[model samples]
Target: MSTNKVIHALYNDDDILMDAVKKVRAEHHHIEEVFTPFPVHGLDKALGLAPTRLAITAFLYGITGTAVSTWLTWYTMIADWPQDIGGKPSFSWLENMPAFVPILFELTVFFAAHLMVITFFMRSRLWPFKEAENPDPRTTDDHFLMEIPVEGNEDELKALLESTGAVEINVVEKH
Candidate 1:
């Protein structure tokens, strides 16, 4: 597969970068990705990207994990191993719920954390031994990069980047 041509821009100000992003998006709706050195608030809204649902999934997984842990503990300790320890009631599942709550909570958090991490990794295609595709090394250090796939007028895009107060511009070819 042929990778798309990426035009990289380095910006110093967030407001300028935001304005540039708006202009680029308004004039041409073909921007592939934008990278910032620091977190820019409301950037996602500017990019028209939807809010993520990972927190919701994590909560649901936590609840499921809690339920499973509770059921398993109750079944094993109350139903299967019904031995009265210290003359306590053998079939007291509800009374001894407090004793098993810590384990249940821990398991729930563990499952939620692990499952959410896995979900994020799988969804983002990030895994072990995966090579990162970074257009410029400086982008991660201190410069913001706005990447546009070169599909139409190259001069117009270059002019747009220059007009947006980009300090530097570089055209990257895909392998």
Candidate 2:
């Protein structure tokens, strides 16, 4: 559980809020989190957060899916249950391989998509059948919020927020 008290600053304009965040980070160096209704360009650069790992995970998942699908199809069709068709010899790996390509492609796509979605949700802390923890409902609709954790000098923090053109400010004790 977190014990830091957070001060929330709400802004209607994302550009102003982004500037405020950069200013606050430059001045205070104690921002906890910022929440916005939608993706704001250049916000991640301003925050100095590392680039996302989703793409890497997705690529690995795609490779795994492709390999698994290919191996499974080959093993089942050629190795395990070899059946002669159209007077062609059974167990001819190259000859029967084309027939597995469609199913292989489908499985690869399916696994890549589904696994990437799972990875995204897990990494983002978002999941189906889970309640959202949106601090302000408006933060989901229109407002952008910057949450700065107060470290004994809240007055200065409040001043910094005000200087950044925060439309509203609220402080809550986190116990």
Candidate 3:
């Protein structure tokens, strides 16, 4: 239930769009979002967004994977049935830990990668069969779009958009 109106400014090139972002931020106007044809370097910084903490989450996931692997190895190899691996069997997991290193590394990487993807999807509101929220389809192909919530001064916003070299500007009302 958004009753706000937004100004969608389209840019022909990412370079120009980036400059527009800087100018808009400098004025203290709130930019709702920006869509780009491709990844633009420093766009996040220009938008004043906080850096992502996914790496930290991934590290935690890796540690969980490591603990799981350790438990599984100890239960299966040492507790249930003990056997000589590489002719070095003291009937203990510590003696056979060298052989488990590869398994630990693989499981850690697997958990980190899969959990990171899932976390990204959940955070972004992206899921299977979910309709995309792209403001303009052209942004996916060759254009960039910046969505700015309109306050009272629509004329001033339009003028600023023009000076920033936006190819097209549209004022849309959303319910």
Candidate 4:
């Protein structure tokens, strides 16, 4: 079995991390991943990642909820048992749409929120009892860590990282 070598660079501040990321990219080095204590705005764009499609999925889920709620309201209030509550027994969904507005809005929000969370978890490959992938616990507190695969230029990479204000750097082998 071949072992892959990677360099883990730790930084103290987010600003330094961002500058280091830009410099690493400028040198055509591929960054495998970055870990931070909190979200850093514009990091995804700096990493050259594509825009997420979660919003599109959310909209579709909302539409599905709307359709389901519409059908349910029609079947129960109009087709199955027409009730003459509020002095209106039109028995038509269109005529009684105002009454179903609340249900439609509520179900739409519910489905969108729930399904979006599920989709995010699935897409991220997150599951219960999964082992953590973080290389350093310090990154979860106040440090930032950047993982980069070593491509045979260890000395050059080390120099580059050191110049970028990395607080610490380590080389590790992964199976």
Best by the TM-score measure:
4
Pairs in clash, predicted candidate 3: none
lDDT of 2 by residue, 1-175 (tens): 8676889999999999889989988884667788998999999989988888788877888889889988897788788998777766666767777777898788888888999888778877897788877788999999999887787878888888888899999998765
List CA RMSD, all candidates: 1.7, 1.8, 1.2, 1.1
The runs of at least 3 residues in candidate 1 whose Cα sits more than 4 Å from the true structure, single-residue gaps closed, are none
lDDT values of the candidates? 0.84, 0.85, 0.91, 0.94
lDDT of 1 at 23: 87
Weakest lDDT window of 10 consecutive positions for candidate 2: 85-94
Which parts of model 4 have CA positions greater than 4 angstroms off?
Answer: none
Candidate 3 residue 105 C-alpha distance from true site, Å = 0.8
Which pairs of residues have clashing backbones in candidate 1?
none
Q: Model 3 TM-score?
A: 0.95
lDDT string, candidate 4, 84-140, tens digits? 988877567898999999999999999999999999989998988889988999999
Q: Estimate each model's TM-score.
A: 0.91, 0.90, 0.95, 0.96
- How much does candidate 1 score in TM-score? 0.91
Cα shift from native, residue 13, model 3 (Å): 1.1
